[model samples]
Target: MAKEKLNYIHIIVTVYVLQLGVDMFRMSNMLAEDFGTNGWIAILIVSIFVVGIIYTIGLVYRLGEGKSIFEILENHLPKFMLYPFYLGVAVLWTLIGTFIGKHYIFVLQMLSFPTTSQSIFNGMLIFLAIILFSMGIYNMVKAATIFFFFTVWTIFVVAFYLPEFEFIRLTTHFFSGGDGYIKGFYRVFVTFFGFELVLLLFPYMQKNTPVFKATLIGHLLLTSAYVIASIVCFGVFSLYQLKYLLVPGLELLSYIELPFVERVESLIFNLFIGEVIVSIGFYFWGAQEMLIRLFRKHSKAKKAKKLTLALIAGIFVYSMQFDTLIQVHEMLHKLSLFHTAVIFGLPIVLLSLLFWEKRKEKKSNAKSI
Candidate 1:
């Protein structure tokens, strides 16, 4: 039997789930630091650009006519020239994906496994990602679909803070707080990073798939989640406290009380494990697929699987040097710059190439006539 293709809903859920990574833990805090009172406005501003990015991605899909990014570039460029670029991007994705998982492990260590060595959790996370990637994109989407329900509830948890949410705490200052406006914008913009990976999913969709609709829906959902989180935190905490709090979202959840259970943030944090896993799996799969394309080993299943294992092992070994969350934070801070470059740069480059290719073909046809 032939494998199943992704439908509209699968793509929507994937975009929503994947775009929301460990970033949620701290997005509100970033907004507070950068844009004091009603900093959630920054999220809305960044989202306008994100909508443009998604629209540009949609243009790439229409122009490419149902091809993955690698396929489009490889069609027009020589492997000798393109493979080097491919290798560089694959390595970048590998590092970003690996460390993203590693960053989550670092936080998990502080939250629940203060004494346990991180090697165990890091290894398990990567291993789980490998397994998910091995199942291929189709199965991975289905799995993320299930996990979507698992973590989506956390978005609604903001309602619990309403009683304590005082509008007076939300000062009228428009864009009050800031270490630097540009850096704050960058931090909030990074939350939407993973949606760019959807450019690779075109080849997996069926002919009738309403991909851009799904993409827009998913992107909007993630924006709402972040913006709502920002509003809740702004209402509940003073600007000083919001700026200092590392992750106001998690801290807010940590305050929830119930007759049967106390300190349920840890339990809720466990639910996020599924989201983190799905996000990492997509990134790792992106890396692995890029490597496979670069090496011309796309047909060799065993070799591709081994390549994934090697990537996973290499990432784990690389992660061991980190003994502090500060180190991971610093490293990720640097990586996000490169990650942002690709998120915007790649699509624009592809669109330019596609347009250039069309113009060249038009010239050839004119000469032939």
Candidate 2:
């Protein structure tokens, strides 16, 4: 069977959905607690850093033009280096799955399933992610696009409760401290970490499409969403009140009383399960792609599919062995820097080298001619 071609819009939508995962809704609360009243300013500063990240990510995509990141690395780097790079990415994705799964469990406990075991909840999510990963990228992207719209509609429906927003309380001391704001800015920058997956998705896009435009629009949408969420959390709950909350966005909904529904927050929490599942599915697909490119020589789709299932099963088993969620989160946080380096940093270096080598080759050919 011929491989299906994905256009730029599909790639862009997949990237956007991956980035807007479960984290965005609660990231502001983490930033506010970390940076206090200066969180918004920190978010603004982080947005600037995101521009740099965006440029670097664009370079990675450019380097892998017409090829996936795995293929590009396999062609450019030696086998030894390539294997290590692939391993790093696979480990990073697995760690991400674990981290997100833990958070999902935390959210579930806080909202509805307080009696459930965290391990059981996490195991179930990991199992589901494994199933999704068994499906290839094309299917994953289709599912993501559908979920993306669902999440957007939910966001809008949830926004109607914004009338309960207490602006003065939220803005009581906006931008009071320069130092704290700077620290908060860095935290917000880290929150947008999932955009790095574009490295894997870019090559699958149709040639000559303006990927950067789609990405820019996506980032702007994400920023606006974050800002709105921050305002809602701040306006609805006092700083002291918010500090104790695990997921402030859901808590914000809990305070709202809709005539039609008494437990609107519960509904939003359920929707969030879908959002996180899609997000994890995308990451799992990326990890499988990287692994397949590194270890297998088979170009046949059926063989690749079988290999992907085996790998996901292995990852699921490994995910269950971690004794505690805190250990998993710590490993994820530390490993994320390596992911930043490979997904963002290595691409810039590779692209520069590729460009210089091409220019030199061109000059030599011109002289010879």
**Which candidate achieves the best TM-score against the true structure?**
1
- Per-candidate Cα lDDT values, in order, are 0.83, 0.67
RMSD of 1: 1.7
Q: What are the TM-scores, per candidate, against the unseen true structure? A: 0.95, 0.86
Which tens-of-lDDT digit does each residue in 1-369 have in candidate 1?
Answer: 976788888888999988888778788788877777788899999999899999988888888787788877877778887777766777777787778888888878777889988878887887888788778898899989999998888778788888999988887778876677898888888778789889889988987577678899999998888888888988998889888988777888888988886767787788888878888888888877777775475577467657767866776798789878889888888888888888878899899989998899999999999
Tens digits of per-residue lDDT for model 2, 216-312: 6666667767766776666667676666676777766677678898898787777667667777877777777766665476556465456556665
> Local error of candidate 2 at 123, Å?
2.7
In angstroms, the error of model 2 at 53 is: 2.0
| lDDT at residue 105 of model 2 (Cα atoms) | 71
Residue 196 of candidate 2: its Cα lDDT? 70
